[model samples]
Target: MNREMMKSLNLKYTKKREVILKILEQSNTPMTAEDIFTLTSKELHMSFSTVYRSLSALTEKNVIMKELRQDGKTYFQINSHNHKHHIICTVCGEVTPIDQCPLHELENKLTQQTGYQITGHNLEFCGICPKCSKQAHNK
Candidate 1:
């Protein structure tokens, strides 16, 4: 979490945001707002709207990233500075961060072929996870 993020949101360093950031930093996987709400409400007795508000602020400042799935639910995760993509499991919604950009070469080639300036891209690979595949086989 950066100081500027809080300042840009016109918010000070509150215990609420700190807790939220701590949770995100410690999590091994991305989590939905509902997941965070349930846990934080239990632990901090925070109001649902407050949690939502803080999440919105964090997201707006890019302190956190939001991924809206096909299910219409948005999952939130801490934003790392590295450029990364995700591979999602359609069966179980498991998401794995991909370190290597699959389209890096293609992007370079395209840049060479055309003079158009490329800024950014979003890439997601969807498939069944290993655990889901195993479960399907067992069934």
Candidate 2:
């Protein structure tokens, strides 16, 4: 992805934003602004406020997804473009995206039952991941 898309959306792209996006893209899961800044501050010469501002802009342009985790910290990830929900590990904060969309049928059912058109939905399942489960079992 390039800044041209953001330009079309009337959002100015910056190198700081690019570096942040790259970090989010390279990460296997979502990242907090603090975590991002900690990793890139030396190389990017930016502040926490700068990282936060870039994240807000990226989210505004729909270039990334921001989610408030149970930890009360906001996490960001590269927008997949394909709508998918995440299943998060409660103990370790591991977020895994599931491609299986179970809402299509549920949406149809809800619309048929209530006669109201549903525009969108969000579903995030939470549970202990295998690693956490194993650790618990060993203890």
Candidate 3:
């Protein structure tokens, strides 16, 4: 499947790229380049630079989504066609995917009002998660 996706994107298929994509596919939450590097390193001998470059290429092609959160780290995840947003815990860096897009109606309204084509959008909410809030309250 990863091979076909690369072929469709006109990206040259490489084992390293395949491993990276597999790692992202298996992950439930967004991962930093370092996180991917650690996992990829466990599976095969690959450098951090190689992993980073693969991520960049994939992100540029929209094969994956890149998000920078309040924690100051960039995270990557597969760009599913269903399209979803995320909410991050500002304290512990937990990422939770939001299945429903809250901005679709707003996007339509904006396109109608401004007469501009809305191609895409990115939206993420950040706040203390329940666990973090509970921990803080306990303290």
Candidate 4:
């Protein structure tokens, strides 16, 4: 999340989106629509349909990024241009951004070796989070 992105987000922010993005931005982990709906509804009176529609619009605008879980639920996070992927918790559904990219060198090499223009790529890593690991160990 850069300053420009934050500014742009604020510029185009709607009341619904503001609430949703605010929650995502503050969250240390990515959240599903149901999670967000529960959290947001607790703070303000909003319908699940509104949250779903807002999330759809935000994803379409590239303001927020979406990832699909194995359980068929969709999670969302702020769209940062820093080129990063996610490490998700299999148990608790937590998500953390991996700062370093595995494809950095590959992308550069591919661009140099071939004239084909590269746009972007998607990468995701899934595993148990620390909290879940601890819980499982205790159990």
Candidate 5:
């Protein structure tokens, strides 16, 4: 799949990029470059800069999406046409993707009223997750 995606993007497929893509594919949530680097480093000989470069290339080609979270760190995930939003745990920094997009109707209404095309949007909710809330209460 990585090879096919890279070929479609006209990117020269490399082992490093393949490894990075595999990592992202396996992840259930978006991950920071550092996280990717740490995981990739355990599997193969790769540098942080190389991971960054691969991420940048993949993101530029729309093979992956780059999201800037509240923590001011960028996260990467495989680009899927079934777009969704994320709810982030403020305390634990856990990001959970919301499968249902709540703004589709709003986006359609706004587009009709404003006479503009809505290409994309980003919406993130921040709050304490259940585990964190439990821990806080216990404390």
Candidate 6:
């Protein structure tokens, strides 16, 4: 978690929400709602619905990024100050961060072509990781 994210989270803080944020901050990769509930429920009392609703609120506030996987699961990660995207593994639901943004030229081009002042952009890349590719080949 970054300072900006902490400052920008405009929602009222609750025990469950604080627990969820701590879990996400400690996590290296994005996790699904079930994962959040399972990890925190052992120490805290929270329902699955409460976890999901908390996720929705956090995402709305941009405290976390909601990633939609090809496997039909939604994952959440802490929204770092760095602007980056993810490359997900379709086989095992792995998420890797891509440190570079490839939208600068494209956003400029589109702005000039369409005369629309583009404010921002989002891009997510998904494919089989090397391990998954090798596993598939061995099979």
lDDT of 2 by residue, 23-139 (tens): 888998778889999977867699889999888988988888887766788888888876668889999878888979989999999999999998667677899999999999999
Pairs that clash in candidate 2: none
lDDT agreement of model 4 with the native: 0.79
lDDT of each: 0.81, 0.84, 0.89, 0.79, 0.89, 0.84
* Winner by TM-score: 5
TM-score of every candidate: 0.79, 0.84, 0.91, 0.73, 0.92, 0.79
Scanning candidate 3 in windows of ten residues, the lowest lDDT window is 1-10
**Colliding pairs, model 3:** none
lDDT of 2: 0.84
Query: How big is the positional error of residue 35 in model 4, measured in Å on the Cα after superposition?
Result: 1.1
Q: Which stretches of candidate 1 lie over 4 Å from their true place?
A: 2-5, 8-10, 109-119
Give one clash count per candidate, in the order shown. Answer: 0, 0, 0, 0, 0, 0
* Over 4 Å off, model 2: 112-119
Summarize candidate 1's per-residue lDDT along 1-139 as a digit string, tens digits.
6667677767677888888888888887778988888878756878878888988988887788887766678888888855568888998888898878899888888889997688656677889999999999999
Model 2's C-alpha root-mean-square deviation from the true structure amounts to: 2.1
1-139, model 6: which lDDT tens digit per residue?
4445455666777778889999999998889999999999987999999999999998988888886766778889888855567898888877788878888899899999999998656677889999999999999
Model 1 C-alpha lDDT versus the unseen true structure: 0.81
Q: Lowest lDDT 10-mer window, candidate 2?
A: 75-84
Q: Compose the digit string of candidate 5's lDDT tens values, residues 9-117.
A: 8998998888898899999888999999999998899989999999998899988899887789998988875676889999998878898889999999999999999
**Candidate 2 C-alpha error for residue 91, in Å:** 2.1
The residue ranges of model 4 lying beyond 4 angstroms of the native Cα positions read: 1-13, 112-116, 128-139
